[model samples]
Target chain A: MYSVEELVWNDSFINWVRYNKNSDFWESLRASDPAVEENIRKAALIVKAAAATPEIPVEESEAAEVWNRIRRDTAEPETGNRKWHWAVASVAAAFLVFLGIYNYGKTDTRVSYENLISEVASSDYKEIRNDGPDPVSVSLPDRSSVVLYQGSKIGYSLSGYNREKREVYFSGEGFFEVSKNPQKPFFVYSNELITKVLGTSFTIKAPENSEKIEVIVKSGKVEVITRKDPRKKKVLESKELEEGNYLVENQKIDLERATMKLSPIVKRELTELNHAVQQMKFDFDEEPVTRIIADLELAYNVRISYDKVKWQGTKLTAHLSDEPLYDKIEMICKAIEAEYEVRPDKIVIK
Target chain B: MTRLWRSFIAGDEDAFSEIYEAFFKILYRYGYHFAADHSLVKDAIQELFTDLWRLRSNLSDTTSVKFYLFRSLRRRLHTLAGGEDVYQALPLSENDLRGLQTDSREQYLIDKETEEIHLKQLGEGINKLTTRQREALRLKYYEGFTLSEAASIMNMNEQSVRNLIQRAIISLRSLLS
Candidate 1:
């Protein structure tokens, strides 16, 4: 049997050979080797058998018609449980058809809302309930993510998706991994407070009275502004919070200079920096040998062989890539009052 | 929809509806593949399309409707499949699901052979690769995207994409030969 390599490498020639059993590409070669041509023809037979199975059809009408029926029944304004299945089916049909065609030409670019809107539509907003004690997750249309906390109700508008903004209404707590969109700012409405972000990973807390609305920045910076604040009707008291920062109400603002008073936004940049340092084996400006040895061992999976008397009190300072461990080890050895040699997988200090 | 795409971008409802009708199936099918649930899939596809329609004015600048549909399908599928934690859904045992003989290796072979005979062999050679390989090919070929684009979507390094494409073409050439 021909290998995957042979078949894939000359796929065009093979295909050409398969379709035109006696094409020139093969003619020149086949004249010298009839067996290879025969093999190529036989491969074509196998390929034909596969294609005969049926190409997944791209239908515009069935999906469209399903949605049409859904729109018709749903528009009646008196839909019951009976209509729900059919409505859901129509939406499913539209979804499947759209998927088959869309994946047919897998795109590399992120799909824009405008482009997404043009491709398809369905009318079904079925609730997904997870009874597990753990958090239940629900993904939105724009590729952002939502982890619904226990006992929460969030609804989406599929049919009326092509609006000015992409909004999801949530009645409880949820963490969001929002897909980035410079134009369409994602809004999560909870407890009379609407949190808007471009693209970020954050947990939204909308507890009761002392239940403050908190936006914890996980990765990207989020501009959490009051969507409906009486104080700034046009634009709420907005603050740009970075990673490891908290934006909340009633928090005291640091009055900087007369022109710039820090808002209620507070960032614990130091905390994050400290945590990052904890992961480091050695981050030292003073005695560097111990730290260097610890980091080098972790990097190269090797043990150090050095005299405690010679290297005990030695220290050095350097930034390691944590990659290409040997290079770092060499740099460290040169910096110190010692030298080193690589023995198989292990490094020995001399 | 009664109006054309241009009209929809102009904020015409009729044109928006027409665009919706034309592309609804593509979105729904892709969603079903990803979500594997009828109701969840439907709601996602519908919501995405409706959202798109509402923002039809922005559609004026886009070139291909298909690219938009696929991209949306991927996003929605990621949502249904567990968002950031997509690997949560493990591949079902053959007995658990349809038990159809859809083994990756077998599919790879048949798919490659079929492409060799029917589709452009060079293209098929590129197509009949691992899902990752095929995607890398599509980004490089069909969309003319930079290696960076392929890497971002595949969530791999740009250097990795370059290496993958290079290897894919080598394999393709050998198959053709």
Candidate 2:
């Protein structure tokens, strides 16, 4: 129940009217909420009239020229930046004939790198959707593999990963095994959450029609942030991801569907290792408690506070690979009869 | 918006073309409003797209595509203008004037508003608005940007944008009447 002005001035509704998008839903709304019909009609007319055309917005020849110029500039192998670089290089060569440090102010790749990330992202997307009961498998630009559950779809740009970060749009559940690239992070935008990782594997289940989005990290760490502002409420919004709540591996984050509140990251009780980390095994042969603590610390990137001298000769034989790192620690504590406390960043064993 | 930008950066030719075509007119008109120079506007837009393509691979994410393009166009126009005074040029040429009128809809709207008096009143009402108000109206209504996006383009806060748009709409409606 929006006022006439609000309805007409609404960006998405205007787009809907112009494009006839989501027609059925709007029609049903109008049918149910009859009072807004007159307003809807008036707003539609106003938008239509305002968007009216007398001539092409841009002349064809002019558009052609712009396109032509774009083609020329983008297609050119030896462009202005290169020439400038060469000119600077020659000037340096002539000025400092003697061998000297010449690389200080010679950053020439920056312009091209900037150009690469911005324009290279454009293109038709390769969409992988799973409609049948079976899950669908797809590979990403960074050699990451995704298994989309039934009723799920993922669309990603065709460009292979290079310097740019990898991203994907997922609706419904998707299991991803992303390749490692510390420099370039990979991102997943689900219902109300943006999951970011340098390189890791995880499973995100966000049903298309549902508000709830669950992100569970299997291996490596990921930052899942909820992007919802309580002030700005809209029925449907097609928006880029926002940042806020963060979650890591051996953790699960659930975005409240109704409220769009990002719950805190809870420890992963059932840690499912993805393909990348599946090969890593925590097999040990009567390894000392101190040594085992060190290995576990390295494996999960957590600090373990323990008396190396007291547990120097205490040996334990166990393959606690299947369980999560926390669970493994719990089992080890139980076996060795050691009291332990879990701090935010470290495990203290006494 | 980030996805589109990323694709363009990743050397997706199609994305580049779509972004160019989709934004060209809006950027063109936006630049036109400031300088009233068609060629200048065109060059500014072309340069903007060119620079964007060049730097696509490294551009950060944006929340709104419309806002991002307008912001870029403004920056490009500023650089292209090089401190040259604008708006004194005033009034577009006959050929350039028609550039803003969309095809098919132009005839329809003119026919709908066949009365010269109504057209005059509409024009006068639009002229009555301050430059900022007019720009805000255009960005909000014609360009179909949300208040936030318009605010970003205008370099104003959201509350200011909302007030400007609301005031503009009210004044225009009153003046037209």
Winning candidate number (DockQ): 2
Instruction: Report the poorest 10 consecutive residues by lDDT, candidate 1 chain A.
Output: A91-100
Q: Is the docking of candidate 2 incorrect, acceptable, medium or high quality?
A: incorrect
DockQ of each: 0.04, 0.11
Question: What C-alpha lDDT, on a 0 to 100 scale, does residue A84 get in candidate 2?
Answer: 24
Per-residue C-alpha lDDT of model 2 across residues B1-177, encoded as one tens digit per residue: 566666677786556776776777767766777776778787877787888788876776654666777887876776677854332312223333233332463244334433334334445555556767666766766677777777877677999988876775565445333
- Against the true structure, what is each candidate's TM-score? 0.29, 0.38
How much lDDT does candidate 1 score? 0.45
* lDDT by residue (tens digit), candidate 1, A128-179: 4434334544556665655555555455567643254556655444555565
Q: For model 1, what TM-score does chain A reach?
A: 0.33
Question: Per-residue error at A4 for model 1, in Å?
Answer: 14
Q: How well does chain B match by TM-score in each candidate?
A: 0.52, 0.71
